[model samples]
Target: MSLSTVQQVLARIYTDSKLRDDFLTNPDVVGISFGLNCQEIQQLSKLSRQQVDLFARSLKRKRLGEIRKLLPLTNQALGKEFNPLFFQYSETYLPTGNKKHLLDAIAFTKFLLQQLTTDNTQPVSVLDVLRYEAVRLKMFEGKRLLFCNRFYYHLETLINSLHSDSPLIPYPQPNIGIWFRLPNSQWRSLFIPFSVKRKKIFSFHRLVQKYLAIQ
Candidate 1:
């Protein structure tokens, strides 16, 4: 096989835990499956499994760091649960291409949402924050221009509490936020309390225009 083929196999082994385990357990079989010749298989098998494992762990840590940077608010909100959850995500899905980090963040966000939905134990505020950050990430990637969501708690308060490392008390306070990217490529958000009792007819266009004028 070509040297590039060997490199591809090695890359997969490093990034994929299950494949690494299989290779370590049965190197020749795995090598042959990847079209590695006998000599190449022997060379691969000669490498220390412990070193390979350490390198794999280091790669995972690096990926985790990149993902954390991309989803800072989600990472902060999830706290201790974040790393383990991300590690789990990385095991199943390995992102590729120039936008790999962004893809990883987007995929991990969806994974988190599914997990939260299944567990149903994490505070609803977490879901709200996760979604908001996901939207921000999508906006950054130019995948979205406008986004809107209704949050059960005050969005700014929740974000501030996470940043300040203060206690999170999710008192019910419904609010709606509109996020959009400006013509200059700057992102902005507008928040209005859902409980705001308006005497006049509500016009979303007027509301957005009024907020934009104030800004």
Candidate 2:
């Protein structure tokens, strides 16, 4: 039998939370509205909402796990604030990129930043941490990032404060920042004072060495 119609209905099931709930409560009626014919309705109505919810929750947890692996500092800095934002983000945005988790993590950070600003949020260090990490993650993937050369000190305090449960103390002056992963798979942030041209080249060389070593 042709499965395309059922497949489309199932796609909606996964993407629409409200539809999922309605379908869970009354698949017989709900399936009718989703292009499901009598046979399709009969087959889909047999689906167990309990099992579906369990699987959905598992998928959510797994996605969060992937984000945590990529953005450890941002995850920790937000504490409980991370969950709701992540949930909304995952439900609303479907990422399309080759570097799936990395791209998703970066997109999630941007999503949170947009929401916070939209809500007229108070000064949140967590947002700062996320902005920092998102850029750093790009650098970690070998992308070159240039900044105003003034946000240096602020970046230092932000990176240092990621694991702390307090807001970042903004530095007195405007600052600049550059960050890359170390050989140990640990993040290392460097400012212009210490991140000279030679140091920057050396740091990138180390990135290649680590990649080669891993291979």
| Among all candidates shown, the one with the greatest lDDT | 1
Q: Which stretches of candidate 1 lie over 4 Å from their true place?
A: 182-184, 195-210, 213-215
lDDT string, candidate 2, 146-183, tens digits:
32222334555776765465555655333344454545
| Best model per TM-score | 1
lDDT of 1 by residue, 110-149 (tens): 9999998898968998898898888877887886677877
Q: Rate the local accuracy (lDDT) of all candidates.
A: 0.84, 0.67
Model 1 weakest 10-residue run by lDDT: 194-203
Please state the error at residue 154 of candidate 1 in Å.
Answer: 0.9
In candidate 2 the C-alpha lDDT for residue 194 amounts to 40
Model 2 alpha-carbon miss at residue 160, Å: 2.2
